[model samples]
Target: MGNGHGLVTLLLGAILMGASSFVQGNSSKHVVCYQGTWSVYRPGLGKFGVEDIDPFLCTHLIYAFLGIEETGQLRVIDAYLDLEDNSGRGNIKSFNALKLKNPVLKTLVAVGGWNEGSKKFSVVARDPLKRAKFVDDVVRFLQRHGFDGLDLDWEYPNQRHSLENEDRSNYITFLKELKEGLEPFSFMLSAAVGSAQFSAELSYDIPAIVPYLDLINVMAYDLHGPWDEVVGINAPLYAAAGDASDSTGRMQQLNVDAIVKYWLLAGAPPEKLVVGVPFYGRTFTLTTPDGNQPGSPHIGKGIAGKYSREPGVLGYNELCELMQQEEWTQKWESAQQVPYAFRQRQWVGYEDTRSLSLKAQYVMDHHLGGIMIWSLESDDFRGTCGQQRYPLLHEINRVLFGANTPTGLTQESSDDKPSEGFRCPAGAPEGYVRDPDDCTKFYYCSGGNTHSFNCPVGLNFDLSTKSCDYSSSVKC
Candidate 1:
């Protein structure tokens, strides 16, 4: 669990890189977002579609939940919506067509999700021929669908309905084979990894797996939910001191910083690891209304929203609406950099502009590749809350990309303009701008414009101080 060695090495690398002028050169940081195919079915949620996505906001957009067939071949979970030519409304076609708007956007198909389970992946990974066929079928499927690559979201590799022990090493072999097969076609291969320490340690051979991956998206959210007997934050950036409901000591590690550090210590490259952020919140109903802090007693799932319609869950859009109610009060957890809202006996743990800004800053300070949002449909894309559409995502862009304008908007309205001669650029390739005052501090350039962000506390912008030092060493 110790990250001392990795932390030192990472900082050393950053220092060496800082000595070179190339460190200031433009190098794009990925903004990868997952779009749930099922969201289109939720009519109450405005039936979000691929067209609602702003291709400019994401460098890579993953269309999620492709399943594994019983025959071990990759299957489109929704055949009608994915391949129906008559309607010309296929999700695949519509999603890929976004390239016409922004050629730089790369579309990927994410196979498997929490609901799909791991049985198929276990069967395919254990059998060499089956694995080959699965890889071959997926490559062809992606090609036919005009997708840029494949993202293997097995949910997990060696736990919960999977071959727990052997699946760990077998996963590495399977990825190697898949990568080799995809190399001929130049398809990108990535995986969605579990964040819990036990599962993460047992499920991945980090060193071996990193070599075959173009990106490794850590599912840092869902650390706590209704599944837990006690109420907790959905995706805390750090563990608060009072949480002790879980005896396994795992509760302390259920946060973004711990999860990312675990991967780094396990040999995953920082640049290849993209931290995942949830666009939704985990809701819970309080058993005792007076005591509503995290780890307090909770009876069951919170009431479902009119749009999300699922108990114990609310999308960012729904949460925004809930915020408008006078009864709901919001509180920020500074240690975790997350927020929770309570109204009467209902509570929901979610992220907002303030917390997300801190998360984005973490990504930059830690020298991680970038941020990945769980699903796009959960965001308020219609500007309904008196804010610009996709406000949460826009905050991410503002911090990570220096984008002054909202994702889909070409320019801010004259009334909202920052200054007379400063029109924000529509979009620009991701890169870094040097800070004149400090080499350890820099501005991340995304949609175009520079937003100042600093390195972890005590760390400077100089090449030597680009990566984070040990927490004990830094004031942060």
Candidate 2:
């Protein structure tokens, strides 16, 4: 799925005019978490869980939510919850379980997800003692399971299913207690927050939780995909003007840039923000609303695997299974750097090697924390894992960490440039202010040397190019 990207022009302008101020992050040496998802607990897999690693992609592995504590008993709750039939233990495990050793990989347990545990959390967050007990239980569970941390995925705090909602202030109090409760165990605390709209309504309360969390994983996807009357992007790199307009209604959606900026402006630390990217794509059926032709009934929804005609959402495993059985054509949208496929009258939108590459670039360009993959199991294992292709993980590690990971995609050299050259158009005015976070090379005549612009102290400037190197310690 894709969303509107109004900010592309501005991002492009920023690349062109602010080339000099472009900062190169030391992500190569930094510890970026690649939160892998284990949808449901599958027993025998042990730590390998749902996703059998083709190769290590992240520094951390995040297990999905452990359901609510109800009736004095706590149990895993989720629809399509995958559990090991014979073995009682959930599949989530340590890095060793996945057979990864190079960079340290810590497993974090997620609690209270989406519709499944919302009502239960509402009850716990209201009472301090109940909340404290929940935290204790969480710690005990982690210790028993050998997990390193906890991620809270409460869909929303105060907001309700309808316009009438509960008190929003209680969230801050709940987070404070949760933080205090987890302090003794010295565990990392994280929260999965909704996008801008829900975040605002629910009062993300980032200020109160900052001291308690190592980072916040932003659920930046779901901006668009099959839910709307017409086609739209699942996620956009930049906000576009025509998005949500008649001409672009078929393409309206959300962008990563705006979401990140919004979070930062809302007080989220950029370094402490792990951007979420979906490994799967969304799908929609198309029929000319103006014309009489009837579109497929499943117009705005997920297509199964890469087959456009197929119906419904296919998790990573489902998609992988489909890939093994079919041959599908691929197309890449330059504006979004995302891939999609079309067959007959059906359309499927998903990520490809090229789109993923751009996504990595976006994370680095913005000096944002690391990238987060929804689920590692969805990748083309044979294509991305074996000695030959090393598909998704290979490209991710190579681009983000500069690790010598092997991949089939062309590794961007230190000298790659955008096809249109970095210069602004001839007739463009000179005073345009450019963003310093563009990955492409660019030019600007806005003012005094763009390269020489003053940077916040503690940031290092390389004399060779006058660009800032923000890999290690740099004041924002």
Quantify all predictions' global Cα lDDT against the true fold.
0.74, 0.52
TM-scores for all predictions:
0.79, 0.66
> In model 1, which runs have C-alpha deviations exceeding 4 angstroms?
1-27, 86-88, 244-247, 404-476
Clash numbers, per candidate: 10, 25
Question: Considering every candidate listed, which one attains the maximal TM-score?
Answer: 1
Per-residue lDDT of candidate 1, residues 230-260 (tens digit): 7888999988876566587887789988888
Q: CA lDDT of 400 in candidate 2? A: 71
Worst 10 residues of 2 by lDDT: 1-10
Candidate 1 C-alpha error for residue 118, in Å: 0.6
